[model samples]
Target: MTSFNTIIIQNIVESLNVGLMVISHEGKIIFLNKAAGAILDLDCEQHLGFGWGELFITDEKSNAQFNQVILDVISQQKVGLKHIASYTLKDSTCPKKLSITSSYLTEDDATLGMVFLFEDITEIFNAEEREKKILSRNAALQKERIEGLDSLSQAVAHQVLNPVTVIGGMANIISRKLPEGDPLIHDVQVISEEALKLEGLVAAVHSYCDIPKPIPVVVSAKALFEEANKSANEILDRIGECIEMKLDCTVDKITVGKKLFHTAIVELLLNASNFTMEKITDVSVKVSRSENIITIKIADHGMGIEKHLLPHVLDPFFSTKAKGVGMGLSRVKKIVFEHQGTLQIESPGSGKGTTVTIELPCPDLSCCSKKNSD
Candidate 1:
């Protein structure tokens, strides 16, 4: 009956999908199933007494982590389980992800060493990594295409505007020479005005194409905020009944591209001015620094953005305003990304206010100081 029981146990162990190995208390392999021997690329008869660690190749880091697992299970005299761990083989070119479990082998009276069960997850990990690479590549390609389209649009605007400028100039000269109250004079003046409007449209397109250029200059945050407010004050004055400006900044020198920062801030202010419903009474700009990041938050007390539409606000040519071409926020996002920063927008649904936050990596002061000294 004992021999029959042994045969049944062996058959059950051999039928398991997982590879199984039993090691003796002295770190010698006492028994390994056929699947275990095949997975480890070993001959069961030849490696019966070999140490498991000596037969497999593992990096120092992975080896230490694996040894800790064994020690923990033995210390508690409990079953141990771990998943998605790499195991290196001497002849295999790549590491394999293995789910491993260790438990004590107990007889009627005494406890032997541990038995280890392993499942290979190499294919699973490889498939996940491949998916990630494909997604990353697709995102990069999309960004490149957007950039190329922006450049082409800018070039077309520039080419069309030069000839338009010449025609507008010639019309103005011809209009001045015409007699007062002449119908032709009025017609020429109207043509010049329309041409100028077209020029403004072309200029807007060029602004959308203007990618941020890297300009590492030291400038105080307070001073930059003041400059941006001063630049936008004239426009705010023109829309006096609809918009208000408030600035609150406290940080010192930060390294950034001045023109790009100014452009982004101005765009935000204009966008706020265009959307406010409750007289646009408060457009606030606040700047603060924490750790290694500089954060700028712009909030507007206006008709808040719709939750459904908020996500698309930064996409090119997606705008809620009547006159907006939808490139302003997209340009803001691109500039922020080029500066190795992030831009985030928040709104408490429709009828509430909207807030946009920009965070950029702060320059290392020590490195800047060393460069200046040199």
Candidate 2:
């Protein structure tokens, strides 16, 4: 071919979206297109004239299989079409899926080299994997919800109510009969406290089961924070503990269930108050929009959770505190989920502080308008 034609062909190959590579029968890489360099995560300019094995070989055994496929195509002098291979880069810990195609470069019955074409299919593979996981998770959640309802019902009926009532009544009668300063008075008080604890547990269970469906409305973000602040402050005042909650929100307005959102914030505030008894707590709130999602982040510089305990923090009845019923965060998560939002809790180890984030979709206003009209 003429030099100009060769240059034109090279430019065309370079401009192609799919990765292209040419290796001589001697196992030397003669040409590496830009796309190929990017997909394989290599410097194309330096790799020319280098052995193909130098780039493809890795500690990961998957590369060996990939190399074997290339060898098979060359030995059989056949086209390898749509060969899906797993490739692990030298510096990356994750393996990537690549769709590869190979064909021999021949001239008049003489095979000179081979051309390999490939593209990174990692994102496509990952998306399918994610869908599978979500489907499996939905099935598990369905089973869990049924079992949980049955268990909660049995406990409330047969185990908790009757026993708690008898223990509390007997403890009160015994306390009334005991004289002042009697040592038995302390024992009676202990029984009363235990009974109260059980009663509180029952109330928590009822609250968890009774969360109503949210009615979403577009409301001012500032107004929601103000209302939650007022309610939280009142509870703080009754308890005689003064903790300051400072909020910095950039959001103007959002579409959410007003009452449910308030509950979620207050629950977080109360939980934060537990750690900030000795120090002032800073509650940082920020709202930002990305694509069709709006994210609200609430962060506090209080005693954060430990790494190992973070995973179970959302589990119902799981508590890190001695007297905690562990339903507070659970209720908050339920409220967020019902609103079609996701709740995430992250901490920078113990004592470093924690951040809880809520992400909700930014609904098209026209849809809301149509709903209102109907």
Candidate 3:
């Protein structure tokens, strides 16, 4: 009968998935099961008579804390459970996380040694980390989709409203000229112009929503800025100001889709021009390169963005402008991200002017040159 009971106990210990160890009163390991040996990266025979602290190495601070827990368990002569704690093995390649439950062994209510049950939780921890990353990525994608839909709606509303506004203004003007014969004629012409403007706006919205396939090529930064500035000549002249372009980058070329790059630069230029104070003499565009990053900064001396609004500027449909549809900066942000870059806006509250900085990963000139030559 005693032999039968001993066999059953051995079978139970061998079948357990959790690691098990029995420690003497002197903190020495007296018994270890196969699972415990595997966790400590040792054979059961090799682990016997070794100190628990030596088998599961921890820092001085952690060792002190764990010793206190063991003392408390021994004094109370009760079972104690501790949350999973990480331990770095001295000679193992992988870290181990374990939950330890300790209980004192007693014979006729007199204390003897203690038994520790160790459960490895490393795989559970890794799965939780992976799940967190997946959730984070899904959240970001959902936010982008919602923002895109909102921008589309705003663009449509702006397109519809622009023509209606133009037509209304023309109707008011022609009301006084009704007696001059062709009263409705001027209104009709105005409506046609307004309709064309709306069509152009709608086209911009379509292009923004359905991005074209990328045609990657090396584009000259200096040449692109020069062309964009020239296109904005009329606006500069009307505003009685000059845009100063400071090109400090040695790497003149970047790999990008030419048309999209051109549009991004133009949009930034237009934004700068529109936002500058009339008395401000210059809008500065500075280009520089450092390490493997290319940076472009556009600064305007205008009534700067409000401090509270700066955080939300890149959000779709969020605008400080009285008349804007608020998609310009949002579109710029999207384009910069597509190019593996970041866009940041800095301002000192309301009256201090604003600066928009764009940083893009620099292209490998060697590879680009080889491709171009080929």
RMSD to the true structure for each prediction, in A, is 9.4, 12.9, 16.1
Residue 352 accuracy (lDDT) in model 1: 84
Tens-digit lDDT track of model 2 for 140-244: 795589458747755674578788989999999999999999999999999999999988888887777778788989898888987887787788777776446
Cα RMSD (Å) between model 3 and the true structure? 16.1
Candidate number achieving the greatest TM-score relative to the actual structure: 2
Q: TM-score for each prediction? A: 0.58, 0.61, 0.50
Q: What TM-score would you give candidate 3 relative to the actual structure?
A: 0.50
Model 2 regions more than 4 Å off: 1-158, 178-183, 240-246, 365-374
For candidate 1, what is the total of clashing residue pairs?
Answer: 0
Q: Candidate 1, residues 31-74: lDDT per residue as tens digits?
A: 98887876666787899999866655355655455566565666
Go through the candidates in order and give each one's C-alpha lDDT: 0.78, 0.83, 0.72
**After superposition, candidate 1 runs with Cα above 4 Å error:** 1-49, 57-95, 98-124, 215-259, 277-280, 283-299, 305-326, 340-350, 355-374
- Weakest ten-residue segment in model 1 by summed lDDT: 56-65
Best by lDDT: 2
Error of 1 at 311 (Å): 7.0
TM-score of 2: 0.61
By summed lDDT, the worst window of 10 consecutive residues in model 2 runs over: 365-374
Which tens-of-lDDT digit does each residue in 127-161 have in candidate 3?
A: 99899999779858965885677576657767676
